[model samples]
Target: MENEEILKKSQKEISVEGTEDFPLVEVPESERKGFWSISVVLLGFTFFTATMWAGGNLGVSFKFWPDLILLITLGNFLLGAYVAVLGYIAYKTGLSTVLLGRYSFGDWGSKWPDFVLGFTQIGWYAWGTATIAILLTKLLNLPQGWNIPLMIVFGFAFSWTAYVGYRGLEWLSRFSVPLMTILIVWSMTIATKDAGGLAGILGIEPTKNMTIAGAITIIFGTFVSGGTQSTNWTRFSKTAFSAIFGSLIAFFIGNGLMIFAGAYGGLVYQEPDIVNVLVKQGLIFWGIVMLFLNIWTTQDNTIYNFSVAGCNFFRTEKRRYFTVGGAAIGTILAILGMYNWLIPWLVLLGTFIPPIGGVIMADFFYKHKMRYPKITKIKFQKFNWAGILGYVAGALIAKYSPGVPPLNGIIGAFVFYVIFDLLFKLFRINNDHVVEGEE
Candidate 1:
C-alpha cells in the first residue's frame, strides 16, 4: 500500500512540473493532435513577412509566366518534401529536433545542435520584433525614439502564446489562419487587377537577373531553419499521414502563398512588403491588421522553437520559463538592431543549418533503422564523431559548392554520415552505440 502511494505521488509531481509540453519525452498518444489542428499551427508558423520579401526579390529577377512560377513551384516542392520526411520521423519518434539529436549527435554533441538551432531561432525572434516595431513606427508616423520602446513592448508581448505552449499556439492559429488567408487572397486580387491580370503580369519584365541555382537557394534558405525545427510541433501529430501531409500543406502551399503574394506585389508596384502593397491599394486599416497577425503568429512559433531547443540544451523540463527568457533575450537583440542583418543571416542559415537535418535523417534511417530505444534505456557517448564529421563535411560543401547550397548541404551530410558511420563500425570505434531496440 505504501509503495503504491509513493508511485502515485511521484507521478503527480511529474504531471504538474512538465505539463506545459513534454520537453524531455514523447507526447502520449492520448495527447496527440488531429490533422486540422496540426495544419493550422504549421501554417501559422510558415506565414511570415520575411518569406514574402524573399519572394519579392525573386519576383524582380524572374519572369512570371515561366521562370517565377517554375522556381516557386520547384523550390517549395523540395522544401515541402524535406520537412515532410522530418515530420514523419518526428511522428515515429515523438521527439523534437534536439531530443532526436541525442541518438545521432551523441549526448554532448547534441549541444552543438542545441546551440545552432537555438541561436537561429532567437535571431529570427529578434528580427521579427525589430521589424514589426520599425514598420509600425513608419506606418503610424510615430517618433523615431519610439522604435526601441515599441520593440520592448512587442518582444515580450509576442511570446504570450508561446508561454502557454502548444495549446496556446493551436488556439491562436485557429483564429488567425483563416483571417490571414482572406487578407492575403484579397491583396493578391488587388495586385492582379492593378497589373491588368495574367496578360499584364506576363508582360512585366524582370528588372534584374538571377541564376536558377541562386534563386532556388534563396527560396530554400528562406525557411530551412524553421523547417528543420518544425518537429517541435509535428511530434504531436496523431498519425504519420497527419504529420507528413500537414507539413506539405504548410511548407509547400502556405509558404508558397507568401512568396507568390510578395512576388505579385513586387511585379505590380515595385514593392514586396505586403503591408505596403495593401497601403497602396487603399486598405491601410487592413494592412495594419494583417501585419500584426502575420508577425504575431510567426513570432510566437519562432520563440517557441527557441524554448524547445533551449530546454534540450539545458536538459530541463521548464519550457515555459525558457520561452520567457528567450523572448527577453530577443527583445534585447531587437533593440540592438537585428532587423538590418537579415540577408547575411539567411545566408548563414542556408549554409550551416541544413546539415543538422541531414545528419539527423541519416542517423534515424540508417543507424537506428528508424527505431530509437527508450531514452532511459540507452547510454550516449560524449560525441558521435560520425554525425559531427558528416555535418562539418556538409557545411563545407554548402559554403564552397556551386549548385543549390541547401540541397548540397543535405545530401552531403546524409552521404557522409553513412560513410563515417560505417568506418566507425569497421574499426569498432562505435562499440558503445545506442542500445538496440525494435519499433
Candidate 2:
C-alpha cells in the first residue's frame, strides 16, 4: 500500500481496541490484557537506541563478565522493581500516571507531571527519529543534505502506529519486537566471534575505571523517565502478577539484552550501537534492518507516550491531533540536531523525573491505603502545595546530595511527601471544598 494511503487510514478513526480514551476512568476489567501481550510491549518499550547507548558506554568500563552482568542485573532489578511497583498500582487504580497525579498534586498541580512527562517523551521521539536518519545516511551513503528531509520522512512514517493509538502500538510491538531482538542477538553473535569469542571479549580490559555506583546509575538513568510513566501502558494489565512479570522480565531480561548487545558491540568494534558495529563487521544489510527496526519500535512508543501525555494535558477526547503535532515538532527538532545537543540534558532530566513517581507511589500506597477516591466522586484541589514541594525537595536532593541522583530524588520525594501529607491531615489542613463521597 502507498504510504499516503496507509497514513490516511491510520488516522481515520479508533476502533474499540484503540478507544481506551478515558484517562481518568478505571479501565474495565474485561479490557485488561494478560502477561505475554503486556510483556511484549514492555519489551519494545525498554529496547531502544538509548539502552544501547548506555551499554556502549559500559563497554569502556566492563570490569569483567561477572562484574558487568552483576552491575546491569542489580541496577535494572532496582529500576524494574520500582517500575513494577508503579505498574501494580496502575493495575489496581486503572489510571494513567497523569490521572494518578491528580490525587497527589491536585487538579491544576497535576499539570506539572502532565507537562514534564509529555515534554520528555517528545524529546525521546525527536532523538529516536534523528538517530534513525543519521544511521540511514551512513548505511545508504546518502549526502548530509538528506538528513533533515529524512528526519521528516521517517517521523511521519513511524508515527502511523502511534496515530492509530493503543491498538496500533500493541500490534507493532508484537510484530517488530521479536524481529529486533533476533537481529540484535545475531549481531552479538557476530561481534563475539569477531572479537575472538567470549574469552577474548572478556579479556578485553577496561579503558576507563568505573565504580559499581556509576554502572548502576547508568542502568537506571537510561530509562528512569520512561519507566516512571509506565502506567501509561501498565493500566492495561489484567493482574498485578502480569504487571510484575511484564516489568521484571522486560527490565531484567529484555533490557539486559539490549544493554549487553550494545556493550558487546562496543567492546568488540569500538562502536556502542550494535547496528553500527554490525556494519563495521561488514553486515550492512543486517545493520540497516537492525537499525530501522530498533528505532521504529522505540519511536512509535515515544510518540504514543506523547499522545497519552497530550491527551491528559489538554483533557481532550481526540488525541490524534496531538499525535500529529508531536510528530511534526519532534521531526523539526531532529532536523535541528536536538538529539545530539540534548543527550546530557536528557540524562539530567531522568533524575528529576523519577521523584514524581515516588510522590505518587507514596501517596497511593501509604496515605490512601491503596484506595483512591473514585474519579467521578472527588473534587480534586487546585493545588496540593505539599506534593509539589515534595517533588522539589526530591529534585534538589538529587542534584546536590550526589549518591545515585535518581534514587535520591525518589526516596526524598517519597519521604517528604508522606511526612508533609501526614502533617496536613493532623492540622486539619485538608481542602475544605472537597466532598467525602460525591460520586
Name the best candidate (by lDDT). 1
lDDT of 1 by residue, 1-439 (tens): 9999999996785576447688888776767899999999999999988888888888888889888999999999989999999999999988999999988888999999999999999999999999889888877878999999999999999999999889888888888888878888888888889989989988999887779988888888889999999999999999999999999999999999988888888878776565577768886677778778888999999999999999889998888899999999999999998988876787788889999999999999987899887776777788888899999999999999998899999999999999998898888785245554621
Candidate RMSDs in order: 2.0, 6.0
| Cα-based lDDT for every prediction | 0.88, 0.79
Cα misplacement distance, residue 310 of candidate 2 (Å): 1.5
Stretches of model 1 off by over 4 angstroms after superposition: 434-439
Index of the highest-TM-score prediction: 1
Poorly placed runs, candidate 2 (over 4 Å): 1-20, 209-211, 273-275, 431-439
Error of 1 at 348 (Å): 1.5
Q: What would the per-residue lDDT of candidate 2 be over residues 1-439, giving only the tens digit for each residue?
A: 6998988774553233246445546676767888888888888888887788788878877754787778877878888888899999999998888888888788888899989988888888888888888887888889998898889999899888877766777887887788887877787778778889878887887776667666777788777778887787889899899988898888778888888777777777666564467677787876677668767877877887787777777777566778889999899888878766544754576578989998998888877889886776778789887788889999998878867777888999999998888788789887322756543
